[model samples]
Target: MAMLPVYILAGICLSYIILLLSLLYGWRNLKNNPRFVSPFETGFSIIIPFRNEQLHLPGLFDSLKNLKYPKNKFEILLINDSSEDDSEKLVQEFRKMHADLSIELLQNQRESISAKKDAIKVGIDKSRFEYIVTTDADCKVPENWLQGFDNYIESQDSDLIAAPVIFVEVHPEDPLFRKFDLIDFMSLQATTIGSFGLRKPFICNAANLCFKKKAFQVVGGYKQSGNYAGGDDVFLLQKFKEHKRKIDFVRSNNMIVTTSAQKDLRSFIQQRLRWAAKSAGYDDSFARFAALTVFLMNAALIIGLVLCLFDASYLQWLMIAFLIKFNLDFMLIYKAAVFFDRKASMRSYALSSIAYPLFSSGISLTSLFVGFKWKGRGYRK
Candidate 1:
């Protein structure tokens, strides 16, 4: 019946409105959080996991060398995941050059399918500090990154902290691919911060995540999460949530970790597919509902366009749907852009918006049947 599509469209619009309100509430809560800066007293163990990241290691080491925290209060643990490249040698060389820093190189003891989780566990097992922080080989940390966390933990009494991560334009003259990736990644980061505002935090990037060593041990330390290749951050967050542990999101410019965008479209799509695959493993009903609502909203727009081919009247509804979704999404992403201080990136939002529905729906469908390759390894749902 013609009314079926109308009803579905109504549902989609309502869902977007609910999502928008939730994000708005979350954004306000995030902004209201008083910025706290206290003396650095908590000792931290920073963990970097890698496989064939020889080229990126230099920049990471340079960033690590520039950290403003007291050298005695933190140690760097580089866990090599059996890299075929010179990643191990690079860490060793960097350690020798900075002998004054408490840096150590260790091999990833793989015992399951999730090599990254195994690598992180290995580092956590060897960590000597009270806190554990994880970042990627391709990421660069701010000088005040540790200081921000220290201040936050000291003030909030948090067991886990999720910080922001942004993608930097690799080329001075940005390509369309890079711009698209930036917008998409920003939307995710916005959702992350907003979810915390809503008090239903779900997603967090391991690239800038910190948690207490004792809390991790109490939560069983990724015993069953190793079944998935990804979600070292999100899955663990869920466990902490289940145990009613205290977690907070650190929303500060100095805490943001900058990472490189994928160089090519193939790599970009693969990365997204890997991320999407983790959704199948999410136990959080709110997260699942959010994801489904987003997918259906986008799918309706795509489907509405096709329906307009036969019935021109459907064009009116499609336009209304697009406008509603566009305005809501823009509001949320704009708040995130302000926080990241990359409002100039919004120039690409219009183009990225047009393409996102197709891209997201495609990734969702592909994730159902196709396995994705990450760091020379393949995984399936």
Candidate 2:
């Protein structure tokens, strides 16, 4: 019976190792092979929802101006979710400057807990095109963003397409915590792609998502999980899966969207808590299983380290166990880093790995018992 703790630790680590292996296999299976380019035939209604995002609005507007897609094929709908700052003024100025482009600014009518969802619903209602593409106000789209979606739509019969999102590049002289944030986010992007490759796509980001307006209406337009403020992308993805609508992930790097990371630890924690709080609304069993397994593995590692301090005998075994998980994590994240062309960020991976168990466990626990703040508002699961 004295060996029971070791057995339990092995079980937890083994389960996680298997999960990682499957994700690695899935990642390998999902490839972006260069192919003959298709004509940009699908028209897109670009929907952007914002609160107080005056600082990031200019970057988005600049990116929009640089898009290579035909101006007549896409329209921009900027939904203002009660911004108190000069965000509205920025959008108005952009509209006046680019009167040749189809752009409209609309106010968000809050009918649900998720203000972003309400804003998106309003945009979809006003959209003129058949395809609804969404990105956050803080994100900068690539020049081929719409063209990439059009190519994918013309080739695939998918109803929803999820593309990648990455953080702005981190310089070597930047703070170590910033690299940590980039790696953490890249892991999420990797998992997203891997899950799609495995044909169990569970999570997606609103920051780079495209779907049919008919699919949105068919799924009842977030009415199923409208109570949650944070899962505007994930819950909608779950709904698509339930209704058997075809979903695919765009594998091209040119399709990526760039966004900023939280600057400080306090804001980072709050952001993660807000994300964790939305897990309660996830009906996808694979998503829940993946979440629980990751949490348990991290929590187990923390407990094992604590036990090592009390008993020296646990040190060697714990180190071996830690190395096993560490190598697996490195493989997954390193692949993602290469895909995003941010392998330089991997220099901080060792330090970040040592800190992650504690950080993840704390966030998971805090999210369950405590509320988190987003966009100047507080939320609970």
Candidate 3:
């Protein structure tokens, strides 16, 4: 029993030290914030794929109205993924309401298990510009989002770019969840951006990611891994990383996309499980290593907790383990929060920290089952 706790303790310690070192390495690569979210004179076709987005359209339209870019320079093409709801009608409503901007509704032609990827592919095929940016239909985008992408593209000689996604809700409304969970998420976001700064990044969200049309085609356009119900972002990112280390992490708050929070715990778990399931098939070595380290750290912590229930000696070591985890996580998240301009909701972070490890550990195990329900559809890996 004692040996078990010691083993787990060592794993957490080692992982924390590595994360600390990586965070420092990332801090040095800071550059001027590229304003891709703004309305530059350059033309762009923003691709937003949707199945049922009726509930989110109000917020979406509100954000669309606030975009700082010129209406003539960029257009919106919303892909309707056979939504049973009135998503197409909603788009029509928007078009009628705002006649100044180009807004077109494209029906997604179904081809594979990855419906979202197919929608994006269809959008890519229809885009008019060399720069293709993808965001979710349910997100609230920053006004200057396009300007950041444009500036970054002009400044950097890169093809693939990863942008940050922030949570829009101030409070999750959940009962007594620590702010640490939110903090941890921000830290992970920072680490992702930081890794790009260090020129070894492997994390990105499709909620605000952009790519050059040429590089996306050069990598064969997700055909290699389109079967995955998830990973439209990560698999494509691996291709970018492999082809060139020129992958950039977009850090400007203007380039960020703010997404709504999950409605409840069940939704949160399923969402996280979907993310964890993709870890098994990642192509990037650095990504795999990072995932493995996080897994080991969390898994070990859970094991140590079980051991502590029987062996009293592990109690002190537990405190040390938590302190290391908290301090390191806090440092990374603090930097990221500063960049995102989001103050940490520490109440959620502290409780979320305790729940996050167990939550991640459980989802990692559940992903081995290979099939899950998403949006009332069955997805199999």
Q: Write the per-residue lDDT of candidate 3 for residues 1-381, one digit (tens) a residue.
A: 447657757776886688667866786575647334432645678999998889997788889878887777788889988899987788899999999988888989878788899999999898888888888878998888777777777777568778888775355554443243356567668777777777777777998888888788987888888678888998898887777646777666667788866666566666777887777878777777777777777887787788788887887787788778777776777677677766646545666677777877887888988667676687775
The CA lDDT of each predicted structure is 0.90, 0.90, 0.77
Cα lDDT of model 2 by residue, 310-341, tens digit: 88788777887789878999999999999989
Best-to-worst ranking by lDDT: 1, 2, 3
State how far residue 288 of model 3 sits from its true place (Å): 1.4
Q: TM-score each candidate.
A: 0.97, 0.98, 0.92
lDDT per residue, candidate 1, 91-159, as tens digits? 889999999999999999989889999999999989999999999999999998988889888888899
Q: TM-score of model 3 relative to the true fold? A: 0.92
Clashes of each: 0, 0, 28
| Candidate 1 regions with alpha-carbon error over 4 angstroms | 32-36, 170-172
User: Per-residue lDDT for 81 in model 3?
Assistant: 86
